[model samples]
Target: MRLVIARCSVDYAGRLTAHLPSAPRLILIKADGSVSIHADDRAYKPLNWMSPPCTLKEGDGDVWTVVNKAGEKLIITMEEVLHDSSHELGVDPGLIKDGVEAHLQELLADRIETLGDGWTLIRREYPTAIGPVDILCRDADGGTVAVELKRRGEIDGVEQLTRYLELLNRDPHLAPVKGIFAAQEIKPQARVLATDRGIGCVVLDYDALRGIEDDKLRLF
Candidate 1:
């Protein structure tokens, strides 16, 4: 599958965030309204790796398909995947989205506590009053953080986080310390922005959050 490029920015930290589609095309339906994902050559080539009606797995993910050799037809799809990475990674886009949210939750719970003991963390979905902040954290220290979730794609900068930062600055309870813009995938410009403004930003890859053993999901 061909990967689509999105615009992004970067910083000295090598952190990044791409300007995602207002609503990512994580899901794709064929002319028949059947579901499909955008997979790279790696994902597409093994369509027949299994039997006609078989279950295939990838990167701890699953791919399901059925073949009707009687009609020279094959039907391939994910078992329970969702999210937009279907186009790029060829996995269920929905699964990618869910993974992103899960990762965010895990990261927040495990790390937010490291910032301080008395700190209180919060979680918010995309598109808050300021914009889409996948995870928004506000601590007892009056610090706030904004996270943009990305499953996979072209890494870009956090333009939305900047807007969130502006909003955080307005909040009396969260204005003094600073805002943290976090993401699993980010662009170069985003890191630069955070550095220049003296704000904190972090970028994590899939491997980074794996095996993290936190059962509690932070409110943010």
Candidate 2:
């Protein structure tokens, strides 16, 4: 990750024309070729950002241009750079990867009934051409459901579930497989997208899931 604090102005030329007046702001350049401009406030959300799969070119002096595949261009003119530094964040295995999310998957598989009455898990990491579906289950009516699990559900997660459903539904045995996007927290946009595409969104309760596991252990 590279961070640059500078007095800069920005102009974006694309579907719509937008401009940021000359001011002191923070510029973030990621390893994936994404660039974002941010003001001092607004927490984590950048004021403007170009996602990855783009190109960046540094021009003579303090000018930089970023362009994406869609022909969108972001021109940044820096009057003065206050500070510039880059840091190696190294590989991120992801948060709560081992304990939280993985355990959630295990608990959900054991307590498939939480999804619906008579729902039973067929398998975890169900295979698909693209990738593995988090869980494959059979509902009360014996219909197959392909579930995608996430720590925090976003639009991309919904898209992934959609893709798995598309592929799984092609199989005769899993024909018409339904999709469920399960996450501890789901964004409003993601929920809307899932509903629009006839997918179900499940907001998981991590603590409750763990408690269920504990209760079963106690009974045993």
Q: Which ten residues in a row have the lowest lDDT in candidate 1?
A: 5-14
Instruction: For each candidate, give its TM-score against the true structure.
Output: 0.41, 0.56
State the lDDT of candidate 1 residue by residue for 26-119, as single tens digits. Answer: 2233222222223334443221211122222222333223222222222233343333232333332222347556765566655665445766
Over 4 Å off in model 2, which ranges? 1-97, 213-220
Each model's number of backbone clashes? Answer: 33, 0
**Top candidate, metric lDDT:** 2
lDDT of 2 by residue, 74-149 (tens): 9999999999999998765433456778889998999999999999889998866556788999999999999889
lDDT of 1: 0.43
